[model samples]
Target: MLEVKVKAGVPIPLDVSFQVAAGEVLALVGASGSGKSTLLRTIAGLYQPSEARVAVNGAVWLDTGAGINLPTRRRRLGMVFQSYGLFPHMTAAGNVMAALEYLPKPERAAEAARLLALVNLGDMERRRPAELSGGQQQRVAVARALARRPEVLLLDEPFSAVDRSTREKLYQEIRNLRRVLNMPVVLVTHDMSEAQMLADRMVVIDCGRMLASGSAAEVMIDPAALRGVGLREAGSVLNARIVAHEEDGLTRLDTSAGSLLLPRIEGAAGAAVRVRIMAHEVILSRDAPQGLSALNILPVTVLALRQGDGPGMLVELQAGEETILARITQRSALAMGLQAGDACHAILKTMAVAQDNVGVMQPVI
Candidate 1:
């Protein structure tokens, strides 16, 4: 586990504390210059805090009160930055071999080759950074980082430099690597979809303060939390399993709320997936409508009602073990008699489910 507690410093003038368990990915998400990268640097021992305590497992990396601050090299951490940061003069194999200099001279070559193969870059080991594509260079960087066999891994917007297709492929690679490494991973990203896809837990920071921290599903569904960080469009996330693919260009998903039919998804049957439901896309009705073009409708009980800053209102609903949110005008909410404990039906159009809002669920080990 990784524990961090910082009072205030040159990085960010705010108090923050959090713990990340082994094999879990904790994402730091916020606008640019929100101190997300600063926190990661602090944890990696690249930055000194005014007062802080950082630890991993039973080892203490920084204790300002005790005058103990380990250097970056002594922290045993693997970090992949936005830039690949490869040596222009060296081949991919050479770059990874540099990280294994502590090994015996005879063992370095074989170990470097093994690490390259682990990252699926064995065939490209002899290629230099200039010859490799953006994705390949990032893969080489990852291989070099893992060559050290560090205790934790830090990724700072590692995929932002790649194209959409390349980013998607890299996402799958990171998911697979997580299963093999099973170490704590901390990622910094501004893309909410990326955070939803890769992070087990997410921390929203803004103005040098942590606004919210929880499971991605929990944090995304909470309007107050999202608004605290200045995200206006509130949404909810649901875990579902792809049950079948209809011949009529629709896919069937089974969630705790019920069966949901949406536009065809890219995953095969039996694959676990996460779906994001935007609050503004949902329509609540006191009575179930019989004739509607909407393909998805679920019975839900109102959990709470929150007034927004404008004329809108947020209605929280509970369907089975899952919670969903709907945004409606205050006048419409009053007309529908929306109140806590009232039962209603949530209507959503199939087309509103965007491709980016769906992602394969990462297995928890």
Candidate 2:
């Protein structure tokens, strides 16, 4: 368990506590000054926990009860900071070997090279940090951290410097490393998508306090985070069954809302999934839209309609537990006579709802 109770000279303690399972990554996510990075610092022995105990893989790193505070060196942990922190003069392998001085010299170079390959940084060893791209530097940093073979690994906004495409590749590499190494990972990040993709579970913090922690799906769709973070546009999408594939190649989905057909290419039947419809994708209709090419027509009751996403109104409707979106012009809103507490049909194009727009675990082929 990694725990903390920080006062920062305040009247009340900012209490937070959570743990990452061995070989699993638990992402710490929150807004600025939410104490996420601060908490990471505390766990790595840079800052004292003050009141709570801290342990990693059954080893006590901190215990305020007995005043058993372990120094940073003795903690047997590795960390990658937001800065990457590679030496400009040293080659990639040189940076990696720097961390393994604690090991016997005989095995250090080969082990360092092995970890570099683990991060797909093979043949980049001779390049200095100054000669490498931001992503390559990160790979060197990650390789260096793993060189110590620590039981726990902590990462603080590890991908902040890399481009989105590079970040995606690095994300996969980190996930692979965790699985193969079996080292528990604690990631502190402000990016929601990053947290969702990497974490087996998540711990949400705000104002230096833990607010919620659970599986990614549960925590993300929690009512509190949606409202608190001004993420009112965010809503949940439930699984829909693919009932049929049309001759025109459009795929039809039989959801609780009746049926929705999209021009997306067909996938295997019986696939369970979910996707975000960005409140803007939804438009209200007092009656059925005539001569429209749209295939998704949902008979929905207005749950709540509010001013949102610019001139476009946010219409929260129910087709069951799933939430859908419709972005309509204000003129359409007025002409169609839409309002809260109104029963309206929603219409959207089938082709508009791409399968790539959906996200979930892909079924094994």
Candidate 3:
């Protein structure tokens, strides 16, 4: 487990405390200049806060009261920055081998090759950073980070530099890597959707303070958390599995809520997936409507209603065994007399669930 407590007033203002369990992915989510990167730097021993305590498992890396501070080199952690951070003159293998300096000279080459292959860059080992594509270079950076055999891993907007298609591929790569990596992984990103897709739990931050920390559904349904993560980005993730692929370019998925149909999803039958349904795209009706163009509809019970300062009302719904959030105008809520225990049907367009929002949900290894 990784535990961090930081309270500082200078250079950057922050008073955040959180813990991440081993084999769990925790995402630090906030806008730019919110001190997410600073907190990550502090944990990696690259930055010192006025008052802090950082520990991984039972090893104390920093203790301000005791005046104990381990240098960055002594911290057994690997970090992948937003810039990729590969050396311009070194080949891909050379970059990874740089982190394996502690290994014997003879073993370094073979280990580098293995790491390259892990990131799907074995054939590009001899290529320089400038010669590789943006996505390939990012893979090299990941390989270099893993070469250290870190006790903890830190990813700072690692996919922000890649294109949409490349980002999706990298997302899958991370999911596959989690099977073998047992350490705590901390991801820093401003995108809420990315956090929901990649993290097991999320910590919402604003101006260096933690506003909320919980599972994706818990955080997304919170009004305060929505303030940090814009309400416009508010949504809930559902656990689903691919059941079949129809002939009309649509994939059938089974969720706790109900069966749903969407644009072709690239996964084998019985593959687990996470489908993100945006609150803004959902329409609720007292009864199941007929003759509607929307292909997906699920009967849900209203769990609670939270009215924000604005005209929007956040409704928490229980769809089967899963919880989902719906953002509707207060005016409409009053018109529909929506309240706790009210039964309704959530209507979702087949295309409203974007391909980018759907991600592979890997089983715990």
Candidate 4:
């Protein structure tokens, strides 16, 4: 496990404490200038905190009261930043070999080749940064970071510089790497969809303070937590198993809420997946309509209603054991006579469920 408690003033005034279990990915999410990067740097021993205690597994890396502080090299951390920090003069193989300096001189070349191959850059090992694309350069940086076999990995917006198609490919590569490397990982990102796709748990930070920390499903349904980080839209996540693929270009999933149909997902039968349901896409009605074109409908019990600044209100509903949120106008809510104890049906169109919001679930490392 990786544990940290820090009070700092150099980068940004921060009072933060959190723990990331071994083999778990914890995402730090917030807007710009929210101290997410500062916290990552502090953990990597790049910045000394005014008061802090950082430990990994059973080793203590920093302790202000005990006056024990390890230097950056001593911490043995692997970091990949937004800017691909590769040597402009050296080839990709040379950049990775630099990190393996501790190894025997005769073995460095072969080991660097292995690391480069692991990141799917074996063919581009002889190319320099100027000759490669933005995505290829970032891949070299990732390979170099892993050359030392570090105990923890820190990624700070590593995909922000790449294009959308390249970023999606990188996302899949990272997910595959996590299964093989069973270590603590802390990722910093401002995109909620990216965080939900990559992280097992998420921590929302705002102005150097941590507002909420929980499973990705739980945090997405909590409006107070999203509002704390200045996010206006709220959504919920559902864990489901793919039952079968229909001949009509639809996939069937079995969720706690009910059986759902969506556009064909890239997965085999019996595979696990996570589906994101946005509040605004849900239509709540007192009675189940028979002539609707919607493909998914579930009976739910209203748990609570939170009024917003505008005419809309957020309704919390319980479908089976799972929680779902709906954003409806107050006038429509009153016309339907929705109350805390009322029974309602939620209607959703299949087209409203975008492919970007769905992800194939990965095994816990």
List residue ranges in candidate 2 displaced over 4 A.
1-13, 232-365
Candidate 4 lDDT over 1-365, as tens digits, reads 89989887665788889899878999998888888888898889987778899999879999988999999898887899899788999999999998897899999989999999998998988999999999999899989988888888889999999998788778877877887777899999987777878898988888888878898767765666677654344777777888899999999999888999999987778877878788889999888889999999999999988787678788889987788888899999888878998999988899998886777754333
Q: For candidate 2, give the lDDT of residue 346.
A: 78
Write out the backbone clash pairs for model 3.
Answer: none
Error of 2 at 23 (Å): 2.4
Clash pairs of candidate 4?
none
List, residue by residue over 1-365, the lDDT tens digit for candidate 2: 44434444353246876766677788888887888887888778888755757787677888878788899988877899898989888889889999999889998788788988988888898999989998989999998888888878899999998987677667756755655767778898887666766677877878887777886655644546544343533433545776677788777667888887766533466654444454445656787788876767889887665554455555567776665545456667777777766888977666555443454333335
On a 0 to 100 scale, what is the lDDT of residue 170 in model 1? Answer: 85
Residue-pair clashes per prediction, in order, are 0, 9, 0, 0
TM-score of each: 0.90, 0.70, 0.97, 0.87
lDDT for each residue of candidate 3 in 117-175, tens digit (9 for 90 to 100)? 99999899999999999999999999999999999999999999999988988998898
- Residue lDDT tens for model 1, 1-365: 88988778564675677888999999998888887887888899988779889999879999999998999998888889889789999999999998887899899989989988988899998999999999999999999888888888989999999998788778877877887777789999988778877889998887668888998767765665677554444777888999999999999999999999989887778888888888889999889999999989999999999887788887889987888888889999988777899999999999998877777644333
- Give the worst 10-residue stretch by lDDT in candidate 4: 224-233
Query: Which prediction has more favorable TM-score, 1 or 2?
Result: 1
lDDT (C-alpha, whole model) for all candidates: 0.85, 0.71, 0.93, 0.85
